[model samples]
Target: MESSLATSQMSDEIVCFCGQSSVTRTSLTANNPGQRFRSCSFYGQPDAWDYFSWVDPPPHPRYKAIINKLLRKDNSKRNDEQQLRRLVKCYQIALEVFLLGVIIQKIWL
Candidate 1:
């Protein structure tokens, strides 16, 4: 399944009652996974007016399965990236500590 960003771009023709362009978004809930809708860009904000429209109908069961699979893959990649960032931070700290120890030893000699 393609990302909502692309769909939002294509929804430029859709405008809210407030005169703002509508944006496409995907439902991430367990029941409506990957469902696409167009809503006001400010939809959910304090100043938002009630506005919503569907960009695509609910996917067929087989397509839903495919979208769910892609969602899982994307989530896994995000998790892996986060873990790598944490690991790199730890390595950077360790390197800094090691360099500090080396500097202390040189000063004592």
Candidate 2:
């Protein structure tokens, strides 16, 4: 019974944080593409991340600065605020999903 419970937790079980149904599975490739051992499902797929800003490559020197400046609460610019809020919200959602994956991994594995 204990082992079965563990196995069930290891399987792709989706539980939403907000009392809704979680629809996505946790996969290393979906979470981290830069890792050479993983395959990105959206690799080379057009319109994959339609809303995210295109950072030509990861580890760009200006990327963090851009994100910070855009996220500044004091910034009165409408476009900057909108972009920052959207990105931040998306980040928060992804974080919740990732953390959920970790917890489930621990409980049932």
lDDT of 2: 0.43
Q: Write the per-residue lDDT of candidate 1 for residues 1-109, one digit (tens) a residue.
A: 1112223345447666676677789887555678888877877788686677767787788877887888889999999999999999999999999999999999999
Per-residue CA lDDT of model 2 for 1-109, tens digit only, reads: 0111111255554322222222322222322322222112232346332112222344334655554554453455877879999999999999999999999999998
Report, for every candidate in turn, its global Cα lDDT versus the true structure: 0.76, 0.43
lDDT against true structure, model 1: 0.76
**Lowest summed lDDT over 10 consecutive residues: which window, candidate 2?**
1-10
Q: Distance from true position, residue 70, model 1, in Å?
A: 1.1
